[model samples]
Structures are given as structure tokens and as C-alpha cells.
Target: MAEFKPVKLSSPGHSDDGIAVEVLPYGLTIHKLLVQTDGRIHDIVIGPENPTDHVAQKYTNSIVGRYVNRVPVGTHSFERNGVRGDITALPNESPLVSLHGGPKGFDAVPWTLLTEKDALQLFSKAEAARIRAQPESSFAVFRLESPSGDQGYPGSLIVEVLVALISPDHQQKISENTPQNEVDNRVGSLALVYRAKLREANAVTPVNLTQHWGFNLEASLNKGPETLSVKHHTLTIQADKIAELDSDSLFTGRHVPLTPAHTHQAKPIGKDFPEKGYDDYYLFKDDLQSAVPTRIPLSSFNDDSDFVQDLLRSSDNPERGLRGPPAIELASERSGLKLLFDTNQRGTMFYSNALAKSSAGARKKIHGGSGVSGSGDAYDPHTAVFLELHHPLAAFLHTNEKAGEDTLLTSEELYHNYVRVDITSKQSPA
Candidate 1:
């Protein structure tokens, strides 16, 4: 791990009405997201107090990749170039599963910062326009290259993450030169765009990346004597079908209708949650793209959109290329804070921090800082929730036909997906 300082990003030229963020080079981690709502600034994203603490906290707002979730051991063999080979990933979880890319995944590695010139060369004119439309937005491009067989993967992979903070006032710039119906209305949004390419032409490897950032909306808004937790947060996932999991929490290769407990309809997170909070994958039930107006032309960025489109158009089945809705919502009533999640990934994994222990000792050095105050004590079980967007777990073990398209990429194809978070105040009119 490398020691890096925090890079501050503020929208609207550091005005109080916009969003501010902090980033670190280690793990390409998001240190803080300070959202101003109702005259108060709330730090919606939670992690360790100091920037260096991120090295020990692997998944705390870090870009988790190569493979997002658990992979059953012995299931590493894949057919590439008409020949089958095995990926010998370390068994980090017990002795049967490799949890999070074999221990030292992308989250645990230090990524290099890409120069603005090099980063701009990767995009087209239209994409560059979109990037410039964000006024006073700070852009940080983090690059990471994973060598072939680094973690038993088959090919060398290069990945870049673009973190941008689009202040609320930039809506005017983003909506310019667009039809009234095609405009994007999101405000105070943070865009995290991930792009990857395999270094070898004949090599094949599994690629599913996601950011495992936990959210405690009221972490900085608690002013009363009572403590705040994520139990009071209301959630709504736009999916009716969920992936079935066995006792070990691995995918069972079956789809099950969402039960009442798992199904969310502006429902409070605390009610009907399992003993350890939610850790389930939900499959979308509707066509998200149809409802979402295409803006900025993502296909121009050399992403896997073409491959996914071909799959959607080729298959006669309506569910062949199902994706989550443009936005999944979570709200905190106490703080009057609302978070809207938009992604292009296949599905979402909702995980509440049910098994998290106290962080008071680790956060002791960051108490009473400038932005927000940390309790330096354990809030409770389910203190925060993680909404991760990525391909299905263990998709690398299955073929594209079985796991849908773009689950694994070829040498000629580039991997791209994004998760955008838009924060606003409930007190404001919708």
C-alpha cells in the first residue's frame, strides 16, 4: 500500500449550495461526499476518518474489481482460445471461496493518477463536452494495471476510473443543446465511470467491477441525543426477481421471486430484515434504457455497449438483457437526505453492514474534523448500506450465453460501466 493525501473536489466553485468530495489514490477510494441539504452539509458516505485508514479497510468506498463478489473454489477453469485453463486464485474465504479477487484485489492496490492530457485522449469530442459541462467540477482519473496471473486471472487488464463531481448548478450546462425530453435533470451528482481493456488479444478473463461504498445518511446530521443508523432509511429497488443463494451465500444458479422481506417498496430497511441485514442480489424486471434517455453517447467511449446491444437485439427472449432501472432510491427521513443511484450494470447487490464491529478506535484520530463529526463509537448493526452495481457473482465461471453478455470480455472489446449517485434534500420540491 502507498501513502497518499486527500484530493478535494468541490462543485459550483466551492459554494455552499453544491456538492463536495474527497478522493485518495490508494484503491481509488472516495474518502468523503459532503452534500448540502437544507442549509446543512451532510457527509453521506462513511469510511475511516483518516485517508491512510483506507489501506486497512479494503472495501470502504474502494473500487473492487477483477471480480466483485465471492467465487467458489474449483470453479476457476474457463475455456479460452478453444483451450480450457484454470485460474488459481487464493482461497481467501475459508477454504472454498475466494472473496473479493483473492485478498489483494484492486481495492487493496494503489492506483496511479492519469494526466489530464492522457485521460482526455481516451474520450471523443462529445464525451469531452460532457466532461467540460460540469462547471467547477474536479476530475480525477486513477489508472491501475493488473498483470496476467496476478491473481490467477488469465490476461493483463488495464483499468481507469473517472471520478467527477457535478454540482447542482451545472444542470444548465449539461442540459444545453439537448431536446427538452432528452435532458438529464439530476443535480449534485457524482459520476464514477470505469473503463477497462484486456492487454492480450487471445487472453480471456473475468471482469466484474463495483464500488463497495457504505452510506449512512445521518452520520453527520445527528444533533439530538438519540443515535442514528441506517434502519430508518427507506429503500426502493426496481426489481421483482432476485438471484437465489445457497446457505453459503453463493449463487445457486436459480432465480426466485422476491419475498416480502426482500422486496422493497419505499419500505424501511429495518423492518423484516434478516438477522445479519440484507446481502442479496436482485435482477431487474423492466427495460431500464427505454425509460432512460440516452445522453452523452456512452457508446463512443469504446465500452461494451455494442456487445450488450447485439445481445439484446439478437435474443428473442425479453429478459435476455435485463438491467436495473435508471435510478434506485434510498432516503433518510431524519436528515431529509435522499440518494438516487443510477447505473448501467446488470444487477445490484444490496448489503447492509450487519456484521460490522466498532470503529471508535480506528477513527479516533479524525474526531471533530472540518467537514463532519464521527461518533468514534459503534452506531449499531445495519449502520450503513451498500448498493453495488456489477455483473452477477461468479459470472466468470459461466459462459456469456448462460451469464448474459459482457460478463467476460475479449481482447478486442473494452469493459465499461458506471454508477452515478445523485443526492438531494427531501425538503425541496421534487
Candidate 2:
């Protein structure tokens, strides 16, 4: 390994009326919460110097996990050395059900930071593994140990989330000296990384850990439903059949369409328009073909509006062909931490930022006088998408973790799956 440079942490930047923020060298900044003079508690996120190049792609500034977005009860069992332990309901839910490993998730507590070259070690000792995440690297990890009578929940769970800023240099061929015609594998791109470990102190149990990111590609304050397109995107799975939804169109398994279901394969956001949004998941069929590779213009996604067509033409990358099918590599930067699932937890959630409208986005709330937005510019259907790796919430019927004990999920690594994830101007299959 190359010698790592020490991370540079700075003091908080002063704010006139709000909280202050601190910057980190590895493209990270921390926005500590502040109590306003008006008796209001404001939320702040740490970010990198270049929010777009370094921060936005990092998903690190905040630690976002707490039972990490809805979990089903009864879906998980508790055991200690083969002995059955009692389980409880999860807190924070309206109806009460076990969500993110029973409260005290990594994001709920503070973390100790030990920085080294190219890596930051954060440790948390909460009752259960707890952590939070922003759109960039620089996450926190909390830990805890069970003290007594395996009360409502079973065995003790120990989880450690190792977070880092994944800013590896892109080995693309773009150089000052290379002939304009020759290609160099040295393109500069900025990104972040998050990876963690979970173990049961006594027995074997199922564990699931995932990140939550809200993306808006158009830079619209209301996360307008920008255009969208999925090209040459093929989903392959081992299952012959998968779960379907009751009323909604959402699927409950790592759904991928069968080879014959290519009818809806490569399409445009303009094709679907405003009538509906994509908050559903499709099951992957077993014999699916591998994804094709392409860069730059992912796919031409625009409405009949001449303005929309003109916008894409002006910024689209030449390497990324605007014509033909968009190649689908489905690649994400944080290697080795790719999600693998067991049959017990066999679904993936595909959620569009359905709730992030204009004023509802990251904009600061204006006081008094009439503010902007509410003009139908909030969360549109085309801004961005989320491919969550988890099980259906319906599985766990009842859950509670007030026991202040450990409730961790532990499992083995499965297959190696890679997905192409883009944060900038390049095409889909770069």
C-alpha cells in the first residue's frame, strides 16, 4: 500500500445565526447542529470542499441508519449458541415494529475517529450497531454489548461500520501530453466509500446493513422530475419466480425481468412522463444476458419540449453516445461491500425520490414573508432513483429493542455482483 498522508481536520466555520461547519482534507466537511438564537434546533451536514466533485458522491457527511428505513417483524429470529433468545419490538416506528437492528443504530450515537492514510476508523459502542451517513464519505460507527438476561431480544450483536472517502483516481486516458487522438486511462473523478462489519457475540443470525441517499441530478431546488433512461440494462437472478405487490406495482424480491420481458427494458423518462413515477422493483430473471458497456450520454431521455432536447445536446459527453441503447454496467465505487442476500431476505427496493419536492429539498427554510416553490417544482418523477438492498418490511410483524441489548444480524458473503453508479457528466457504462 502507498504511504497515506495524514488527514487534515479544521475548526468549525462560524455562521452568523446558525451552526458552524468544519472541513476535512479527504473531501469532507462536518456541519455540527446548532441551536439558533431563536430557540430552534437546526440540522446541518458535513460536506467536502467541492460538494459536487467530492461531497455529493460521497454520501458520508451524515450517518443515515436507524433500523435503516422500515423492516418487517418475525422475519428475523434470535439465537445464542443454538438456544432461542427472546426478541422485542423496534422503537421509532408509529405502530412499533423492529426496524434498524432495534434502535441505537449507527447514526443514533457519536463515533470516535482514528484517521490514517486514505482511511478513517470510526468506532461506536452502542447497544446495537449505530451509524449515520451523508452524501459523501466520513461516517460514524457505534457499538454496544448485551449486559444480562437475553430479555425480549436474543443474543448480543456487535457491528462496526468502517467508512472511507473512495477518491481513487480514474485510470482513463485523458492527458496533457498524449496526442489528442490517443487515449489515456487517467481521467480524474471524485467519489466516496462505506463498508462495515457485523457479528453476533454468540451465534449465527441474519444481518442487513444499507445506505440511504437522496439524489437530484438536475440541480433543481425542488428535485424536479428530470428526464431518465435505462439502456441495455439486464437483470439476472437465480429465482424462477418472485414476489409481487398487493396494491402498488412494487415488487418484493430482487426482481429482474425475464429475457422475454424486454418490452419495458430500455425506455425514456419522457416516455413515462408525469402520470406515474418509478417507486417499484423488478425481479431479475435467471438467464438474463450481461449488460453492455457505454459511456457519456447514457441514453437520450427528453420530452417533446425543444428546450429539454437542447439541454441534453449542450452537455452530453461525446464518448457517451446519445444514440442507441444505454449500456448497463451498474457499477458502484465502494468495492468489497457490495450487497449479497440470503433466501430469507430476497428483495431489493427501487425508490425514486418521490418525496423531495422543490422547497422540500435541501434549501434553507425562509422565514416570514412569502417564500418560493409550491409551484409544482418539488420532487418530480425524473430526478433520481434508489436501488435499496433489503427484505420486505412485511416480514417482521412485531419488534422491540428497548432492552438496551445487542440485536445484530450476521451472515456470510454470497456472490460477487457489481453495478455501475455515476455521479457526473460521463455516460452510464464508463
Candidate 3:
């Protein structure tokens, strides 16, 4: 195994523009994400000090997969492409349920950092064209090859993750002129793009890759690395329905309308839910528009010269790329920071770290102090929130086929999805 090394990225031409990130190939983890806004730098991601700590503390900002969520013991078996496989892997959760790919999922393994040339092939045709047009953007790609039967999953899976950071100024094409009003709304952002495929011919497998990151928008270095609880943050989720779960928190293959308890419309995150905070899957409504409207012109990024036809095709093929409305919006009045979360996935599993407790473990720091935790620099319950983007919970269960379209993969198809976070500062005009 290659030694684990951390890679740092910053927005092009402005390394100090309050945008910096550190990523580890181990588990494809995002170790640090510091964004400057409101004249302060905020380390918004919850992570451990040592990159190796991710192996034991897997929930930190790392990629989770094979199957992203839960898989009941008996429902672990699947049949696809006329082949059958049973995932008898040891269960990590109670009641013999497999959680996050049965312990040694993608988060527990090391991935290979692909060279620029090699990674170029992994980017979608539209993304490749976009990257070519914006060479100044900062991005890194990591690859992982999972052999058949690893974690009891069927096929050999080749997965690639592209993490990219774009500054507010470059959110749109460089050739376009920005209006003053639009410039104020422009935000610095980070996007994670995933691509996966079966390596063996006719092989079949269940794959649900998702990025798990606990965000603490209250993180800040304005007054010497001061960190606050996420309870103070207000949150909104654009969904009309939520998953119905059993007592053990496993999906019950039923959907229910969002109740006041789970429905968030700019509500205080800490006070809106039950004592532990929300830990449920919110399904996107059919009328939901594509997440976070962007001026990047995704439809025209194709290489084809038939612009009109390409646009029409892109409209018809919503699944081809990132689509869906800003699934979540979180903001902190104190920090004057707002997080616009969007993804192409069907739903998001929202967790408020209800069970998380202060740890003695080391954490990443800036300006000689730590961020993303409550006072005393310890992560307490409700200090951070995780918005896991992917298919519905337990999508691998054959009974929930309709809930998960692309979770079951065959050699003929490729897996693709993305999660984009736009961090904008809502500062009052001086």
C-alpha cells in the first residue's frame, strides 16, 4: 500500500481568498475545508487530526460506499443481470444490519490518486469540457478498485472521485461578464463528482456511494479559532416526503409526508427536531427543480457542435448529470455564512450527530487552533450535521428496487452523481 499523503487545494490565482481544502487518499477523506467569509475564515468540516484516525472514526468527512447506508441481514442478497450474490458480511450495526458497506466499506480502505491524464478519462463528457474551459480551477481525482466478493459485493468496481474547488468569480464561464448584483450572490464552492463502473464483463453489484461530511457553519477564526455549536444554525430542506423507518432506524420501504418534526423551512436545527436531532432520509419531491441553479451552462458543455439538439437531449436526460433543487440550505447568523447543499441524488440522509460526544482525539487546525467543534474544542452532540447524498436507505434490498434506480449496477452502466456546496456570506452592506 502506498503511504497516505494529504493533498491541499485552493482556488486558482487566489490562494488566500478564504478557500482552502486538504484531502487524504485514505478513504478519499476531506480533512479540511476552510472558507473565508464575513472577514473570517471558517473550518467547516469535522475531522480527526491524524489521517489514519479515519479508519476507526469512519464517519468524518469521507466517502462511504459499496452500499452507502443500511442493509438488513436477510435482505443483503441481490440478483442482477441473471446473477445472484449474498452479502453475508459481518454486520456493524445492531440487529445484524450491515452499515455503510459492512465495516470495511470504501471509507476503511486506501484509494489511489490518479494522474491528471488518467483522471481526465473518468470525467463525464460534459465535465471534461468544463474543466478544459476552466483550467485555473483546482481539482484532484482519486481512484479505487474493489475486487469482486470484497465486502461480499458481486462485481469488481472501479470508482473515481473528483474533488474540485471554484472561486466565486469563476463560478461561470470566464468569457461572460458578470453584473454587479450577481457578483454579490456569487459564492466560493466545492463539488464532489463520482464515477463508478463494473470492471468485469456482465458482472453485477449493488453500489451506493455517498460523501459523508459533518458541517459546522459556526466554525470561525475571527476571534482566535472560536467554534460554536450547529444548534444555532437555521436549516431548510426542500422535500415534501420522508422515509418511513422501523424502530431500529432501518428503512421500512414506505414513504410518509413530511411532518412538522422533520419538515424544515428555515427552522432552527437544534430546536426543530426531537431531542437527538434529525436522522432520517428526506425524499425529493417530483416537482423539485435541479439543485442550486448555476450559470455554468451545463447543457452546453458538450463537445458536439449541434448546440440546439444537445440542449434538448440534456433536458430529456436529467439523470445524465447533476440535477435536483438545493436539497438543503443551512445558515448561521453569527458567522454570516450560508451553506447551499445540492446533489443529483434522489434523496439525502440527514444526521445531526445526536450521538456524537466530545473526543480526546486530535483535530485539524488553522491559526494554531481547531475549528468545527463546540467550546473546549470537543465535538458534542448536535455540534455538526451530515447531509448524505445518495439513493434511498437500504436501496440494496431487492424489495426496495423502485426506491433505488442506479444503486444496482451491471457492467453495461456507469454510476454517476455529485454533491455541491456553495458557501456564501450574507453580510449586511456597510
Candidate 4:
């Protein structure tokens, strides 16, 4: 196998308020992410310190698709003009599953640097469009044109992804003169917005895209102990059901009630961490929205505990035209870092890095050294967690006939999906 070397690119004046980011043309990967905390800077996402290490590492801070996640291994069928055709999984990485857009997906390819003005823009030759970004909000957009039969899938597709980092300052502002009963809501937070669009003038295809940034809120790749992991982080997913998966980790088209062990109601991740470490999809409840209202009066709560409880509760009726609360929240009390994840998609895939240790071991043989240097033991199990927003895998399955109209995207209609990540300093009760 030939070595894949990634080209590094930088955007001028992108840093703000002690937050810094670095992007790569390969996969438009987020190479370095640093946030200032306690007067010191720390790297939050696990990524290759050196550009060459990217090829051997997991999709570390990179965008993966044609399709995100797994599509069952075999010949799957789709419909076109009342005719049936089959698209088979490449089976490049796994023998039984087609993971992350086959063996040579977007993450493995190098993109062209189109423009570096307000935001960085990258173009993939295979996929006609460009991926753009801006420094102020740390926003990046991916625009592409996928020709029919590009990746074993049927029909042509035009995909666009908009990713932005929304700071707490942009959220609903709280007033100093507000009543004492109201929550004093001042927390440093950032939201990552992933908006995707599919436009095709003549054909329809399966579309599922997600941002795969594995987060370790407490530890930093540039600082802290080598063995530091995300095992201590607390998790809560606003989901009551889960999609069932077979041994190979493909969705079995079944939605089962969440088990007690899988319950994430402000609970420690390690408390009931699954043996496989969360490679499952949590189907969020329908009544929630993405953002917390700027302020809520104390009349609704009786005490501090009630305040926390109320804050965690999903809005019964979100405002007439507003995004809802996060589908999941991951926090690290040790480092005072908290992450709120909100998405308009139907489900969120939570993956604990349980296989990292083994994967890293295998990567060492192909790559001269470990995937990343200066980070000791950073590839351990449960070192980080990935929350991906998208339709359930079942939506893409085609057994004997085409999927229902709701699951597939058409040329006449536009498909838009949004995912928001709110990074905040956990506030303490008064």
C-alpha cells in the first residue's frame, strides 16, 4: 500500500478569545483544536500531531461519507425510473461491513484549497464542489457533486455540509437585573452546527452525513497524563429507544426500548458503559428542541435540585420556530468542560473508543510509528466518544423493494439536517 500524506493548511486570523483550530485538506480534518481554560490552553479533540500520521489514524476529526457509519455488506438494491439496480459494499476495511463510505471514502482523499478568505474552502476533484470555512465562527462548508455510480450507490448526488462553531455570546443573552428566582445563566459555551443539503435535478439516493469529532473533554493531547481517558465523563442522551444491531454492528431494522444500562440521565459513562462501549444509535424523543431558552424563572422550580431537573427536561412545546435542545450532553467535571449535542436528525450514534487500542496496534505495523506522537497512550479504549447525527441505518436498507418515500431524498425536494454542539463551563448551583 502506498503511504498517504496529508497537506496542511492554515487560515489567517482564525483564533478568537483563546480558541484556535487547524484544518487539513485531507478529509477537511480538524487537525488541532485548542481551548483556553484556567489561563492555560488544552487540545480537546484527538488528532494527528503531524500531518503524515493522518492516514493510519481513525477518522480523527475528519469528515467521513458518501455515507457515514456502516452499510451492510452485500448487494443492496435501489430504484430508478421504475427499474431496480443493486449497489454492493466495497468491503475494503471490514470483511462483513462497509464502514464510512467504503475503503476509499472522502476522509482518505485530499481536497483542493479553493479560497481562504472569510472561510477556508476546499474542492475535491472527484466530487465537483468545494468545502469552505470562516475564522470568526470556525465555520466550514462542504459542497460536492457525486456522479451516478460513483461509489456503488445509484443516481447522482449533490452534497453540501456547513459546519460552524457558535459561541455562548451568540446565544440568548441574560440580563443582570433579572429576578433572583431566575437562573443566573452565564456559561461559556460553543455550538457546532452541521447543516447538510442534497440537491439532484433528476435522481434520488440515500443521504446520511454526520460530523465525527471524537471528544475527550477532560484530557488534552498536548497536555495532561498520557493515560488520561474519557471514562470519567458523564453522559445523558434524550432518548427512550435504541436501534437494534446484529453481530456485525449493522442496524437490524428494529427499534427496542432502551435498557437500564443504556440509560443516560445525567449518569457517569463508566457506570453502565456497555461491554462494546456504545456503538449504538439512540432514538431521541420527538418533543425536544436544540437550544435552551435564555432564561427560565424560578417559579417553575422549588429548589436547586428542581432547577437542575427542569433544565434537563425537554421542552414540552418548543417555540413556533426554534431548534430544540441537544440530543446528548457529555461533561467532564474534572476539567469543567461540558458538551451539549443537538440535532434535527432522527438519531444519534454514540461510539465509545473501545476498539482504539486494538486498532492502534494494527496501525503500527503499516505506519512506521503510532498514529500520533507527543500523546502517550492516547489511543486507549474509552479515551473518547463520538456523537453522530443522522437517520437510522434502517432508513437506507433495501431488501426486496425500495425504502419508503420518507427515507429517501428526491431531486425535486431539498434535504437539510442540522447538528449543534454546545461547549460550556458547567455552572454550579447557587
How well is each residue in 151-173 modelled by candidate 1, as lDDT tens digits? Answer: 77778888877787755433334
Quality of model 1 by C-alpha lDDT: 0.65
Tens-place lDDT digits, model 3, residues 254-274:
779988888888988766558
RMSD of 3: 6.4
Candidates' C-alpha lDDT:
0.65, 0.29, 0.67, 0.56
Top lDDT hit: 3
The TM-score measured for candidate 3 stands at 0.81
* Model 3 regions more than 4 Å off: 1-3, 12-16, 80-85, 117-121, 124-133, 170-185, 221-227, 289-325, 363-377, 398-406, 428-430
What's the best-to-worst order under lDDT? 3, 1, 4, 2
Q: What is the lDDT of residue 230 in candidate 4?
A: 74
Write model 2 residue lDDT over 49-102, tens digit each, in one string. Answer: 222322222333333332334544433455423544334545444444444445
lDDT string for model 4 (1-430, tens) is: 1123333322221123334556666776776666654444556776555666777775877877777788877787665444344567778657888888788777777654333442321112211121222243444444555667766766666554544443333323458786533422223223333322234355556666666777876655233333256777788888888888888778777778999888888898888667778788887775763343211222332222121122222222222113555577777766666666656566788888777763442222111225445445336677777877766674657342233212455444444455544445423221
Judging by TM-score, tell me the better candidate of 3 and 4.
3
Task: Give candidate 2's whole-model lDDT.
Answer: 0.29
lDDT of 3 at 272: 51
Q: Which consecutive 10 residues in model 4 have the weakest lDDT in total?
A: 305-314
| Angstrom error at residue 296, model 3 | 22
Model 1, runs deviating above 4 Å: 1-3, 13-15, 80-85, 119-137, 169-187, 223-227, 289-325, 359-376, 399-403, 428-430
C-alpha lDDT of residue 361 in model 2: 24
Please give the distance, in angstroms, between residue 261's alpha carbon in candidate 1 and its true position after superposition: 0.8
